[model samples]
Target chain A: MATDRPLTAKGLATRARIVAAAADLVFHRGAAQVALADVQAAADVSGSQLYHYFTDRDDLLRAVAVHRAAELVANQGPVDTLPALRAWVEANIALIAADNAAGGCRLGSLVPQLAETDPQTRATLSTAFHDWIAHLAAGLTTMTATGVLPPTADPHRLATLLVAALEGGILLAQAQRDITPMRTALEAALDHIASLATSP
Target chain B: MATDRPLTAKGLATRARIVAAAADLVFHRGAAQVALADVQAAADVSGSQLYHYFTDRDDLLRAVAVHRAAELVANQGPVDTLPALRAWVEANIALIAADNAAGGCRLGSLVPQLAETDPQTRATLSTAFHDWIAHLAAGLTTMTATGVLPPTADPHRLATLLVAALEGGILLAQAQRDITPMRTALEAALDHIASLATSP
Candidate 1:
C-alpha cells in the first residue's frame, strides 16, 4: 500500500496547477524540452516547494501522463447516433483548436519520445493507450446496444478504426495547419459508421 | 539550384551505405535515440567521411527522412486491383516485422518532433508527406479509371483514409508488438472499400 500524505487545501491547488502547467509545456514544447525549472516557473512555485510536492521530475511526468490520459478519454465523451458522433467529433476538433498548434496530443507526444529509452515510461504510455482504447470501445458497444448501430457489429474493430482515423486525421491537420482535412476525414468515417446502423 | 558535387563511383557507394545505415538505425532505434557514432560504426565510415556527406546531424536526419519517404513510396508500390493492394500491404508489414519493432516510422516519428520548433525541418517533413499523398492518390486515380471502382468515387478521399488507416494501424502494432492488428485492420478497411462498389 502507498503511504498517505494528506495535502492541505492550498497544497492540493498548487499541485494541480503544477500538473496543468507541466502538461501545457510538455504538449506544446515536447516533453524533452521542458525541464523541471520550466515547470516550476510555469506553476509559479518556488524550487523548494516544487520539490517538496513531488519527489522528482519523473514523478511529476508520471502524474502528467495520467492527467493527459484522463483528459483524452474525457475529450471523446459519449455517442448515441450519427448526430451524437458528429457532435463528439466537433468537440474534439474544438479541443485541438483551443490549444492552437502548440499542443498536439500529450500522451501521443510523450510515447514516442520515451518509447526507446525508458521502460517505465513506455509502460505508462501503454497503459494510457489501453485506457483510451477501452473508453472508445465502451462507447462503441453502447452505440450498438442502443440500436444506433446494427447488432452485427464489431465494436472493437470500429473502435480501433475510429482511434486510428482520429490520430491520422490529427497528423494531417497538424501538418496542414488546418482542420478541414481532419473534419472531412472524420465526417466521412462517421458516415461510414452511420451506414452500419438499422434505420430508425 | 543546389550544387551537385562531383563524386567518384566509390564515394557514391559510401554515401548510399551511410544513408542506408542511418535509415536502419532510425527505423529500429527511434530517431532521437540514435547517436552519430552509432551511425558511423554501422555505416563503416570514418567520422570525417560521415560529416563530408552530411553537414550535421540535422542534415543527416533530413537525408534519412528523404530516404524513408522513398522507401514508403516503394513499399506502397503500384496499386491496381485487390491483389495488388493486398501485396502492397503485406510487403509493408513484412518490412516492419523484419525490423523487430525497432523502427516505428521515419516521417511519422519526425513530424511532431521537428514541426513545432524548426520551420526548415517542418518544411522538409511537409514535402515528404505531400509527395507520399500524391503517390497514393495517383495510384487510386488509376484504380478508378480502370473501372475497378465507381466513377463517382473520390480517389483522394480513399487515399487519405488509406494513409490514415496505415499510420493508426502502425501505432497499435508497435505498442502491442504484434502484427495481427495491422493485418486485421487493413483487411477490414479493404473490405469496406470493396463494399463501395456493391452498394446500391
Candidate 2:
C-alpha cells in the first residue's frame, strides 16, 4: 500500500508498465475517477496497446487492486521479533509523514473505494488479504516459538489487529494531514504487543 | 458515521431533507459517483430547489460531509465510564455486523474519497473530527475523574487512538466481509485501556 512496498524493477514489460501507471492514477485520483483514457495517457500507451493489456475498465481496476495487494505482501519484512514489528509500524508512520499524510495507504485506500463496487475485484482483494493475514499469522507464530511473545498470544488475532490498526490510523491521519492518529494507533498496537512479550 | 447515530426526525426542512438524501447517496456511492441529478431525484426536489440549497455539486458534497460529521458527534452517547466507552465500540462493531460490513463507514468512507480531492470538504470533516476528538477527550477525561481510567492515561491521546483503532478495524473488516478485524482492533484498544485501570 502507501506505507510500504518497494517497486520491483524486474519486470517493466508493456503490461506491467500499464498496471503500474494505472495503480499510480488510482492512488491519486481514486478508482472511480480514473478513466482508461487517463490511464492510457499516463502510461503513454496507445489504445490497442492498452486494450491488449486489459479488456475494459473493470479489468484494469481489478489489475490495480490485485497489483497493490500482492505488492504489499511481497514487500512485508521479518517480524519474528517485537522490535522488527515496531520498526515496521515506524516505517509506515514515516510513509504517512513522508507523503504528508496526503497520499494515504495505497492498498488500504482501495478497500473503501472498491469493496462494494466490484465483487470480482473484491474477491481478488479478499484472497490477497487472506494471504496477507496468513503471512502475518506465520510470522507471529514464529515469534511465539522464539519466545518473543507469550504462548497466550494468538498470532492470528494479533496479526489482524495490527493490520487493522495500521490501516485505520493511516485513514485517520490522512483525514487531517496529521500523522498523530497513525502514530498513536501503531503505538497502541505495538505497546499491546509488547505487553504480551515475555516480561524482561 | 455508518456504525452509529440515529437519524433524527426532528428536522424535515427542505434544506435538511436535501442534505439527508445526498448523504445517503454519498454513503452508497462515493462522492465522486454521486451526481447532482441523482441528488435532486433522491431528494425529490426540483433543480431550482436543489440549487437553492446547494450552489454546486461540491457544495452539496461538503454539506454531506458536514452533516455526517456533526451527526456522529451529536449522536455520541455517554462514555464517562470504561464500560460505557467500550459499549460504544461494541455498538459500532454491531453496526458493521448489521450492515454486513458492506455499507462501510459514512464519515470514514469520505476520508479516502475527498481528503485529497476536495480540500474544503476535508476541512469541514477536519473540523468535525476536531470536535469529535474534543468530545471524546472530554469523556475520557471524565473517566480519569471517576477513576474509571488510571491517571497515567492521556485522555486526548487515548481518544485519538481509540477512534483510529475503530476506523482502522472497520475498514479492515469491510475488506474481508468479516467482523473479526473490527472486533479484534476494538477489543485490543479497550483491553489496553482496561490494563491502565486503577487496580480493582
Highest TM-score against the true fold, candidate: 2
**Which clashing pairs does model 1 show?**
B27-B103, B28-B102, B28-B103
Q: How high is the CA lDDT of each candidate model?
A: 0.70, 0.80
lDDT (Cα, tens digit) per residue for candidate 1, span B1-200: 01268777998898889989987787666666678999999998899998888888877877776777677666556776767777877876776677544445566766665566666666666666667667767876777788777787767777666666666566656665566556655665665667666333
- Displacement of residue A34 (Cα, Å) in model 1 is 2.5
The prediction achieving the highest DockQ against the true structure is: 2
Q: Model 2 misses residue B101 by how many Å?
A: 1.1
* Candidate 2 runs further than 4 Å off: A1-12, B1-12
Q: For residues A155-185, what per-residue lDDT tens digits would candidate 2 score against the true structure?
A: 8887877887788788878888888878887
TM-scores for all candidates: the values are 0.87, 0.91
Name the top lDDT candidate: 2
Give me the TM-scores of chain B across the candidates.
0.84, 0.89
lDDT of 2 by residue, B1-200 (tens): 22133445542387798899999887776676788899899988898877765678878888888889888977889888887887898888887798778857888888888777789877877777777777888998998988877787888877877887788787877788888778887887787788788856
TM-score of candidate 1 to 2 decimals: 0.87
Task: Provide the lowest-lDDT 10-residue window in model 2 chain A.
Answer: A1-10
Shift of residue A50 alpha carbon in model 1, Å: 4.1
List model 1's recovered fraction of native interface contacts, to 2 decimals.
0.30
